[model samples]
Target: MKLLRRRGAVSLDDRLAALEEAADLADGRLEAAAVAGARAVVSRAGARRSLSVDHTVAALAGATGSGKSSLFNLLSGTALATVGVTRPTTSTAQAALWEGAGSGPLLDWLEIPNRHEVDGTAGGGPEGAEGMAGLVLLDLPDHDSIELAHRLEVDRLARLVDLLVWVLDPQKYADAAVHDRYLAPLARHRDVTVVVLNQIDRLSPEAAERCLADLRRLLDADGLTGVPVLGVSARTGAGVAELRALLESRVADRRSWADRLAADAGAAADLLARASAGAGAGDSGDRAGAPRAAEPVKAPETSADALAGPLTSALSQAAGVPLVVAAVAKAHRHRSVAATGWPVTRWIRRFRPDPLRRLRLGAASAPEGDAVGRTSIPAATTVQRSQTDTAVRDAAAAASAGLPEPWAAAVRHAARSRADELEDGLDRAVATTSLGASRRPVWWRVAGAAQWLVLAATAAGALWLLGLFAMDYLRLPEPPVPTAGEAPWPTVLLLGGVLTGIVLALLSRAVAWLGGRRRARKAARALRASVEQVARALVLEPVTEELSRHRRFTEAVSEARDEVRPGRG
Candidate 1:
């Protein structure tokens, strides 16, 4: 009998734990109303516990002419509640207290100003039924009452009551106002809810059975699949014992309040789960061997690998890396030509500005400020800027695609959060990267020494030729000039020096061309590497962080929905 009569299968501790878990699940995903409602459930549960677990508050509620007050009186075995055919007879809530057991604070919170005491020993309710001594049965005003205050009173008591006995008549059993507005909202409370077909005496047994079956169908459609429904006549006492026994069972159990609260939490949690189910849909696959819900939600998956390449390319272009590379090659060629070319023509190379120095870039002896300073690199053209914008948004979109609402937006924001910093970051990267153009190569110095030696030889040879001409003009004796092959000594010296200097200059120019190209390629690679780093730090980091946050939110909501296993609790 004890097992059969227990109102809830779960202990109070278990139910409370489930409620807390559900509240945790609803932290960020649910609507404001749902979060507030869950908090209210927890708050009310705590308040109810602090007041009295010994007292069970049950309310009998119905339409204006449903005989709910009469049923309440019958259950209490006293005419504690007003009963009449007048519309909205009970404007305020009335309570029938039993066994002189006090529930003052609980009733006050319930706002039941009218109270009546019942003789616990009268009517021989049942032997060994002393456990129901703390029952407070309330007869509430009609939910469909003409008076707005009466309906408001019903709403208030219905939310607070530990148990609810909904009284209905054959005539109004299918009332849309009652079913839609009242019963449907309490679908979560089916375990603590009872549906009574009152005024059964007015119908034949077959008609009453048919009405009860129809009500059961309606309850099922309302998500109250397992709720109990009974047919009773308050005047004939038919099925009244069953209703009273059901109430007594609930009132006897101290866990009924916890069960009611659990139902409320579960309902709130379920609604929140539905709200967020579509969120993070394309996130990632399930965690590696991690336990999940029986039917787990699909998580969102995003990869920054694909985004990295395009992002780096865009940044490289925007930072003028190509122009820098070209400058590096040209600078190398300019310096080489100045060092190894024929000394006389080398001055011509000097007049051409060093390409790197012109751009304020890669000068070995430049000031510290020059190395860290912004370059004369041209601003990115409109096409380049558009490409960069498209790259950033595309990366964000790809990573956030199919993610649930809010989290998807969050990821996108994280990706673009640092967009304003991109141009400056890329510029800084370009400025700081070592483009290898600053260092003068050892070969350039050796070649410069060779060029000076050749120029000196050419100078001495020209002087000898001029001295030969001057001696012939003045009829002076000429110094001995050694002849080679068919050419005169002075003429050979003059022509050979000129031809050798010109040949060395042409060879140096050819070497500079090859070395310049190689230098350009090396510098471009180094600069682009720097650009990639900036992209990762400025763009990828934020998006990854947002995705990580989305993952945590998903786990929290999943745990809240599936962790406790409400049925076990």
Candidate 2:
């Protein structure tokens, strides 16, 4: 059992390693799903210990009246189990332990209580009888029984046993069920199974020999050509000693367990190979058409370029400036608004229209009462914005359509299911990539608020100063005038506030610009990573898996060739 466990662990480790490597090379949901499937296979394989010594059980399965129980008794050298004259004698399983050196622990694990001590001191029946160790023989219910439970027991134990010694009587040696269901299904396990024409005492020597040959032919038809078929009779003890020697050889070498595990591993590898074959063709095309190739084709001012002229034109119109004058007008507006000037006049300028707003760009119409006293933008701007959105959507759809059927369906499902996440990723990527960090910072809002407050204060101070100067210059009634010095105090406060606000706003803009630059760099890196991930999953990973499958298939074909070659040894 421990040896079996170790072998299972090794197989599981190899499978897990392969899966991890594949996962690293893959991408997206396919990578995740493949990794999950591989892990499941590994876990199941780990749970199954192939041909363990603790389970060194061999089922004595045969047709009714085949003397299967008598043979089982002969092998164990004990009549501990009942042998009935009825056709379907053994209705349930009865295990017998062959007590030899190192057989105690194995038998205990197999839970077989009936034991027989085959002594070299008294036994003259077979030479080399001492070699048979750790063999637990099970007397299974008759295979040809009408009772469903008997057949079920045989079928169940057949799968769990390390070896199977199928017993057939002369009367029913060619039973269809025995050959088709039992023999054919286990053709792959030929090394660990044997067939015996039991109760051969009823047939003549010539008839027995011919029956054995026919059985071998049947086995060959079932794809078990190399498996041994022997004629044996429990009553005469004919060929029982030779069968015992074969069993002894199996116990001595412990090669059956290795052979069984190898067969199972080969089967699992075949499954993986088939899956790889199915995925191979799709991988080739996807690799050749990766998304990053679009970048060079869409480069600035190139024939393939579609963004520069349209984007610039759209932004110019949106900013309410003529396409040629938008850049210059934007600079002038910034200088005029930000420059320090006489406190009273600057306060009055706060009520004037922003130059950008005055250019009348943006949506077709500005909001009624919420406007900055600007006219509506031109109709062409709205049309251009709509066109840009449509173009982007159409391009995305076309790209999605070009994917393979299943993959395209999967992409569509993902897009629909995770639209919000995709949108967020796109927005973040665009903003960070296109806008430098220095131009957009959180502190800008605070700075803008402070600048407006200062502007209001300056305006109020200028109004007070003007009233005081007017009263003195025109000799008008000084109605409720506080003092002449009060005007200077307001002017000083206004000037100080304006200066501080201007400095803070300039600092905020600088910080915003720096932040935007950093964000843009980060966005570029993320986009590249995303593109690479898609390329690997859609192209490289599938191709590698397919190639691996093809190589394994070639190796299997080569092995089959070696197995079939005449006198290859």
Question: All candidates' lDDT scores?
Answer: 0.75, 0.52
Worst 10 residues of 1 by lDDT: 284-293
**What RMSD does each model have against the real structure?**
7.2, 14.5
* Candidate 2 clash figure, as a count: 16
TM-scores, all models, native as reference: 0.75, 0.51
Best by TM-score: 1
lDDT of 1 at 301: 66
lDDT of 2 by residue, 21-105 (tens): 4333223423344334444434433444432443355678988777888898778766755677776688778775544555565
Q: Distance from true position, residue 157, model 1, in Å?
A: 4.6
